[model samples]
Target: MAGVRPRAVVADDSHFMRSVISDILEDGGIDVVGQAKNGRDAVETVADLSPDVVTMDVEMPEMNGIEAVDRIMSENPTPVLMLSAHTDENADVTFEALDKGAVDFFTKPGGEVSMEMSRLEDQLVEMVTSVAEVDATAATGSEKQTSAPTSSTRTYVENPTLLIGSSTGGPKMVERVLSELPLEADFRVLIVQHMPDGFTERFAKRIDSRSDYDVREASHGDRIGGGEALVAPGGKHMIVSNYRSGRLRVKLTEDPPVNSVRPAVDMTMNSAAEVITDPLFGVILTGMGEDGAAGIKAIKAVGGRTIAQDEETSAVFGMPKRAIETGYVDDVLPIDDIPNGILNTAKAEVN
Candidate 1:
């Protein structure tokens, strides 16, 4: 037991894919204890093997990855990393799997079968290894809320700009925070959620369906408007351009990735700090890295406010912890309380 490696179950309908994934895991020091040909077999194999993690294919015969994720979460609750194709349809299904409790996802190189997957060897191994450390039960459970903070008097900043960044367990958290905001709040929001190119559009659509704010994927030269939110397109950096007609516009660039991810929080937040002279808010939620730390400092240097999701509620505390360490975060609140923190920061009377 002392020398035992973390075990995983690779589930895919393609025998070739199963072998490839198993080999990758083994090479990464993770033991592939079992393999499954379909979702049904995946469930049964997981039950029997009780592996530390699972790499699940999005599409399969006799059951799909989404269904398997639901069953696993409800029953065993092991960490699941989804393998999906980069298509509009697969994006929707992959999000469904995430909603059903998948820890994270890796976009397959070129559809269901491709030797191109070998190109993603490093990324795949990293994701699977990181996910195995997650507490699947906590990651999938409903968030607990606390009462909002209050003071005697209230003030507000009209038409404030809100910049949000997140990763890992971010989608559900982002949806929750945005949905809790008042429909009439005068905020121009820009969100940078670490995601793949084909997925951000659908991600924005899903958020818009449940949120009161007008949400859509950001396009180049898109003018910022109060009461609307724009999600940065994946695989590109979104930065604030010059102010025009009393509003700032966002520009998408193919610049090199920051912090190893395009559309990084720091990229957007740093740009917003330089252009937007209004009251700005930088919020870093649950994520696995220190992407937003410098952005937090940038915002605070310009007399803007910053908030971080507290570790107790964070699915992974990496980003928030790094931001908090900068001593620039004005409020550290739970996931449920974060919406209030953002709104309250704008409303809290200036001394």
Candidate 2:
């Protein structure tokens, strides 16, 4: 096992796609241990082979990817990477798959099958390899539900801003945190969940349906206050800047990606730290990279409070670990305790 390559099972209804994905993995140094033509086969194959990772197609005959994810997580609990198309339906199902315990998703550049598939070679392989290291069993069993805050104190911060950043295994944590917040909470939240185009809008809509705040995808020139939570749009960096009369607005830019990702959390949080005069809070959640570490430091340097999700509950500890190492984070709490921590910190700050 010392010299063995990581193993993967490629699952797709199309033979051509299966071949393409297998070749990509094998060429990228991963072994193609098994191939499945449908979701049912995918579950059985994974349960039998126990590959290091699984590349799952969103749509397949007999059983779709979402259902397969639920079944696999419930029965076998393997690390799964979803390959999704860029349509609204695929976007919706992809999130569902994620909620059911899929590790992460890679968007199909064009359609289900295209020459563009080759373009995804590097990113797809990286995702497959990265997710292979995740402890799927722990992730599947991690608590997803949050309860009411034990503390009854809520302090009103005038025009305060809260910036949240997350990546792999982030959507569920973001949703849970937002849902736990009371309806009257006044933080102007700007969320930077690492995602690609054609997905963030639907993600914001999903969160809005379940949360109390007026959550929506951020648009250029949109004001950043009045209890609104704006999710940074996919494929663009959202930066906060001072507008007329001391008001703040978000500006979307196609600036070069930082940390290999557009819509980078650093881009948004750093900007807000420079411009926002009101009380600020930075929350670093589960992710795979250090994009938010410097942003957390910048927020703390500007006298804003910072919190990070602890490793026991994080799907991936990279982002939160990096932020915690910065010596700037004021608190490191589990996912279940973060909403209350934020509120208590706000109350303590106000007092």
Candidate 3:
């Protein structure tokens, strides 16, 4: 591992956060090439140092993370990871950073930024190291431009559900796909994104701000509506279940982990299989593990459609590749083609 050390630039407004992130990076076999106190400094540092990865703090002063992300992506185009707090406002800004070009994000784990550092070392290191593998093309948002949906009256379907799952390299993948989709679209979208506790609510809001759909985090017993999208909360399992109201609703449970994660894609898909007698569709995107393979198989068994992100466009190629290998995926598409792929498939499948 001697010559394999990755280099990184750490950017954050909080002195304690910068110190903490830097320390974690160093301990994880990455060289701390530079440290910047604000967003402008982050952009400048990336240009000067050209580190393998950049960690951005979302609420930084001078230039916020979103601005720095745009500048760096437009100019330097390095793999950037953003840091977000548990606060609701920061969640919107945090995912906005991802949409602008930040690779992924991590939440400050504890309720307070206490002296506890061991809680984050492994997870932070793994994410930064995994993220460092992104090529300049993806960091610059290099997927081909797809036309955003123009004026349209989306006819709501009687039984339509879209399921999406992603992990590493997911934030941007999900954001881009959602942004290209018709705002106020006809179907319901459910997402199982691997994230720490307290982040998904804001992530949903961020996607909501950028799209026509009413995107929000799922709550127990919340029934998804037409033209609505729900993201599974961080610490619970989100399952689709039938309510007494004779419609599908989100059920958050404290169930044991599946595929080593609480909000596992397989769990949601399997649960959906039980409650949904409709046109269920699963779109599996980039991530590092085989978390969605079983879920895709489950969906396919139920006669639901499935799409896997192809290897060429996937950042890690692990999760989608596994799903594709299952022979359950009906389509394997690049990131840019996914939105249209889903739309066409939904129209063809749903009544």
lDDT of 2 by residue, 1-351 (tens): 467688999999989989988999999999999999999999999989999899999999999999999999999999899999899999999999988999889888887875678887998887787788778998877575766543345555566678999998899899999888775557788999999987999999989998878899989888856567899999999999773333579899999999999999999999999988878899999988798999999999999999999997887889999999999999999998999888776764543
lDDT of 1 by residue, 198-219 (tens): 9999999998997878999999
Q: Pick the candidate with the highest TM-score.
A: 2
Each prediction's whole-model lDDT (CA): 0.88, 0.88, 0.82
For model 3, state the Cα shift of residue 239 in Å: 0.9
Model 1 quality (TM-score): 0.93
Residue 262 displacement (Å), model 3: 2.7
Please give, for residues 73-119, the per-residue lDDT of candidate 3 as tens digits. 89988888877776767776776777787778877765225356568
Q: How many angstroms is residue 248 displaced in model 2 relative to the true structure, after the best TM-score fit? A: 2.8
RMSD of 1: 2.6
How high is each candidate's TM-score?
0.93, 0.94, 0.85
Query: lDDT for model 3, on a 0 to 1 scale?
Result: 0.82
